[model samples]
Target: MSSTALRRSLLAASAVLVTAGVWLAAGTASAGTLTGTLYRDTDTPVARWLAANPGDSRAAQISSRIASQPATRWLSNFNVGTIESEVAGYVGAATRAGQVPALTVYGIPNRDCGGASAGGAPDLATYQTWVNGIARGLAGRTTLIMLEPDSIALQTCLSAGEITARDQALATATRTLKAAGAKVYLDGGHSAWNAAAEQARRLANAGVADGDGFYTNASNFQSTANESAFGRSVLSALSGRGINGKRQVIDTSRNGGAAGDWCGDDNTDRRIGRYPTLDTGDANIDAYLWIKPPGEADGCAYPAGSFQPSLAASLATGAANPPTTTPPATPPTTPPTTPPTTPPTTPPTNPPTGACGATYATSSSWQGGFQGQITVKAGTGAVNGWAVSWTLASGQSINQVWGGVLSVSGSTVTVRNAAWNGSLQPGATAEFGFIANGPAGTSSLSCSA
Candidate 1:
């Protein structure tokens, strides 16, 4: 070959090496990547409806209800046409800004398997159509996709006949999406929700062998330390079925802290946590994903089926986004008296308060029960009856209460000390508290009245 040709070949090889190096460096960094569903700012299905009718009250109400539920909205939002555009914009901005924002693709039918958290495609036909659109949205993009969360592994709650149908639907969805050139990860629930063998069997039954690998901890809180072990076991089980991957990825969404309960309404507390990291114990185990978006209510801080602005603010802080640091130290115990702050009694005429206070405490505890005490001091006038109301974020409900009368209204939790027990003497203070389960890091005291 001529000298010029030899030089050109060497240059080409050097370029390839440079690209590989960048990819490798990105993989090893301590900063965890972000990954979750891409959705439009609005919360409605007509937003994607084919008919495109101008207005329909029934559809409007359904959309409003579904939009209120973050999980449902997270999954269904992909159906909207604008979602792809939003993601495209984010990718461009991140690329220009020199960052890689990991992303996930949810919105499968039968998500969460008919539980209180369940909402998905209307049917298999609708799901297939939606999948195609999502693939189009992702075409030429570099965002990671956590496909069809909880659709395959959590099917145990279905009947035998229903399971068969769901399996076919999931397999079809996975194959169709993969064909669209989207890398997909079927949710395997979490280490705590299902055993390795069981999850593997279900995935196999759902035809996960056709996809890249399965995902775990999408929205669940199985610890990374525990999820890695569980992931390997599932991978080993798949080994017998001839799946080629060495390992799978797990979600680190709310796993920075301990695990939360499966079901408890008043469990509306939020906790600050680190972002998703790539420190998987095994090589085959891919990067950890924030499949559950920060600021999206987990039914605890938000309404049972809605998003809470206060909760979303708490999630935006670095403490929960790409969790690298530990959350603020929770008060060891409820202080005997309110910290001496003679601030005005009127509510702050503001939105997006800091990550400390009653809302933050209750929203923080949505994942774990709150352990604290509140003393209600009487104002200048003689105090009449007292009510200690604890309103949960969207989707959260009252798990348990002590020392007061507790009432639940959708996502609002109220604890009232009745008239018989209501009087507070002038210059005297009334004290009460309740051990309540909520989301991770919820605001504790809304009203000390």
Candidate 2:
């Protein structure tokens, strides 16, 4: 062979070897890398239901849909004697599966503010010991830790000294969880609760710098868009206060569509939201998660904590976008000269021109009960107050509502603004939710303001 030919052949062989080596490395990384949020793959309520009722079509459907989805495992039972072993077991299983485990370390003192889902360590010392055990069980494995859901958000419910102690406990817990190779996310209340600045300040005070970032909409029914926007605002505020590099994850489990009244029962209108993803496009946003498992009770349908199979099945099988029928235009009601002490049973006839408009949806339903939500949009002008009215289909009756004053007379229901949520500027929106009892679900609802 000529010298030139020999040289060319040698160069081509070298190039081929390098290219093959690159391809092999790329394939190895792709196979071994943990790319997305981890699916714990543990048995949940839906799984248990499916196992017991193999012949039930509804249970089967729900099982099939959520069996593979990722959910946060809660570690809120302070009384459980074997917490360390349980945490270790969960982390070990997740590590073997090549996934990260997400846990909620809920048991802070004064937890849930004595609400239905209330109970925590009797004192701060006990809480610290419990958290230390959790950290010890993690054993330096990569895990996701969602701190107490309402711990920082509901600080106002505590006395001054209690708030100080809560802050110290949270800080200690944050440091402990992080030292064990866990990514800790502090709680930031939903968009509707705290203003961005106030929430950011509270997070900073709770030692957010010791963890990965903050989480929003934990067990709440706010839309992903709204939560994301709120998350950004809070992050920006944190940044302004010199707290940088903080990332956020949102609870998209039940916020499939629009925002709903957080305090309503039977809200079956909620559908499963965006699947968990690490590549959220936004730099500061980490993942969208089912922090609150979809099928679990939200304290309303089944005694605040008990699982409701009917409600769970409804949520699992429902459509993300249920068909909505626009109600016929009703003449605007006259502005009340004085705000009524009670929500009027009858809707006003003349609402101010461009006062507000509303859209309603049945969030979820079971055999004899259903949940409903209303979103009132402020018109071109500011709205000092507003009222919405809707007539239920036969057999439906409003039982309880939150975020608004609800007055029901037979099938017709009138909802007036609650004291705190009554005012809105142009383009602003106010949402309220309620639960009703009926056999026929709220398939079609007409709402007008």
Candidate 3:
């Protein structure tokens, strides 16, 4: 596909990319990143519930928020007759919408290690036949295939022979899907799971080197910051094993609380993390995806994979948190509290932008390169799109950028609104960040919309 088409497809592909939630720390993103849009099914379980229960009090808010968001669709069933046409129809819709459809191939035998999400094709031959249906359905369309969640990470249940068979199956499946123009990401669990080196070894054994990259935090609630760091660590370890230029995608759904609670009940306060987009400024991360759709039960709360409206409502409203304070009725007096000997230092802030102009701020600096961000705000009138440009100082060139699409001509660099972030109401603001080579430099920034 052409670059323009790919950009259009990636507009809302991953989570809004600035890498970190606040760009508070330097990222390990490399240049030449993959960008695209994610497929949003209008037929989610949330949508079905809303259609049937319009009278419910929480329906409207849920419709406005949860129902409209893009989510991953799992192909865990093995219907031989209709599977090809069913997936072909899905591919056709995504093609018409110009978005990259993500399908989670979650039907590995002994899936979830006979845990809540168990069952797959009966054997290796049956699974390969099932995979052949998926490839034909893809019809060589550009697609993102999340090979198997927990397939690589949760391999403890398999015997030595089972492990080798499963890994070989995954490698063959990766090859098959890639042959159909699909970008495949094998599972890498989350930051809280396997250590980087161990995960890297597992990934290499499973043929991650031949695929696009690997995914992390599938259906878990580790913070994106932690996931990004862990992904880079995994990528670094993979590189040491001769797997170079690999990227990562993170699951941001149901993790907005930034906590690590892993369930779908009301007690485990969680919310939607970030919207799907490919503008993550981190070079190593491809996008933030909603791998596990919110509102779906995690088996602990209800039957696994069923949509629960009350749970969805809880996520939408978030946990009702009160301000931190000691309750007068039960103040503890058993132990004395001690304060830190050294005071905490204040952090740097980004300069506010005015009208069409923008200001660049360096968040942190290292030996040769520094991380920087550009804050852009709309002027008095509403605008559909915006662009910011500046001249690169000698020995200063950007390596990667997120939150905007970047273009350059010699010493001049320009970044424009991505497909999803371009339209702005009057005075509305957006920001894009980049990691540049050499020392950070200052230059007058001119922006227009």
Candidate 4:
């Protein structure tokens, strides 16, 4: 059949699938079925960037804030011959480690509307085959599948016939992934993109009844609270259509309370959101995830997919910084007590005075790397901010640090307070840690704040 003729036939077939109620009767699954914590893969884009550019001004801060957190791994390309094996490897490793693996399936035909991430299977049949490969790769393991980012939300870009075909493709993919023990979440776009009722209708057309639920703010910067409300509204619409027992998740990676210019390269308001948690209190909301890894350029500042250290730093420090304030409820001075009847003894020597003090400790050690922490204590008065500097004697180099902004020069490492962790009242303390490459032994580390 000619391509056009075949597509016409498929659209007709999909129309029948939509009206026949085949997808509606499919069993419902809850996002709560997902158990255990999400995994943080050791090798991520930010991790690689930190290793390559240790000298970048924001390297330490970005690495420290992001490396330990869990983010989604995208499996968008379907052309690679080893795609199946790659999926199996990632899912299998995650399962064995007692962590949940989140994967994004973005290989729908005409993906991304021919924009920055514009590539996918050329036709529905090829796309189905690729999705089947992804299913086989799952090997019946529990996984989180973000079906597609823009497939449904952007259906307006397609003709009526094309929209029908796209719906069929999404429906097929959702069914296939669900059958393979994956929890599927269709894209509901951000709260700002489509009305709750409208996006819910799109999700229904894309066969959400056969899947777990839908996700909002996939790659956008909508606030968590806003996305939660939006997701519930979408689910409410779905329930009104007799699609109940559905749940949702939001991308909280960069929605640091500010929705900056979506296309600007120098958006410094981007800060990290809450860490992933399944206990979101709302029974309908599953978890807040870092769907779009921070520091990855959003088609500007750098190449669309390249890592921008400064952008990542902004996420690490942006909203996290709060103004320094005196410690709440300082003890009031009392009248001097009368001198004891005993003869006055020599006045005790005063303890050493200093601006701040820090103590270093090693947390864990592996073959070629170790994790260490530093605790900074304020002395005498409140501190607006602090910087701790230390020298590594055993050739140890930091690859990642969290909870502070870090810079390295030769063997000396310096860390400054992040916006969120600064402001220590008198006697209050703050701590930060880092993972570094060195011999598996203690080194002469000194800290001054």
lDDT of each: 0.46, 0.63, 0.68, 0.65
All candidates: CA RMSD (Å): 17.3, 19.6, 23.8, 19.9
What lDDT would candidate 1 get against the real structure?
Answer: 0.46
Where in model 3 is the C-alpha error above 4 Å? 1-32, 318-449
The candidate maximizing TM-score is: 3
Residue 448 lDDT, candidate 1, scale 0-100: 50
Cα lDDT of model 2 by residue, 1-449, tens digit: 00000000112221311121111111111111123335345455444545556677675546545545667777755533456787887877766554546787777756777554554565677678778889888887767778999888887679988888888889999999888767788988888888999999998989997777888887577888888899889989999999987888788777775566774247767777776544466666766667776666555433343345666566666544311222211222443222211111222344334568776655544445555656777766778888888777877776656567878787777888776567776776666666566753444333344
Task: State in Å the error of residue 157, model 3.
Answer: 1.0
Tens digits of per-residue lDDT, candidate 3, 172-268, equal 9999988876778898888888899999999999998888898888757888889888988999999899899788888887778847555655544
Candidate achieving higher TM-score, 1 or 3: 3
What's each prediction's clash count? 81, 14, 13, 6
Candidate 2 Cα misplacement greater than 4 A, ranges: 1-34, 320-449
The window of 10 residues in a row where model 2 has the poorest summed lDDT is: 1-10
List the candidates' TM-scores in order: 0.53, 0.64, 0.64, 0.63
Q: What does the lDDT read for residue 267 in candidate 3?
A: 49
Off by over 4 Å in 1: 1-75, 78-101, 263-274, 279-281, 304-449
Score candidate 4 by TM-score against the native: 0.63
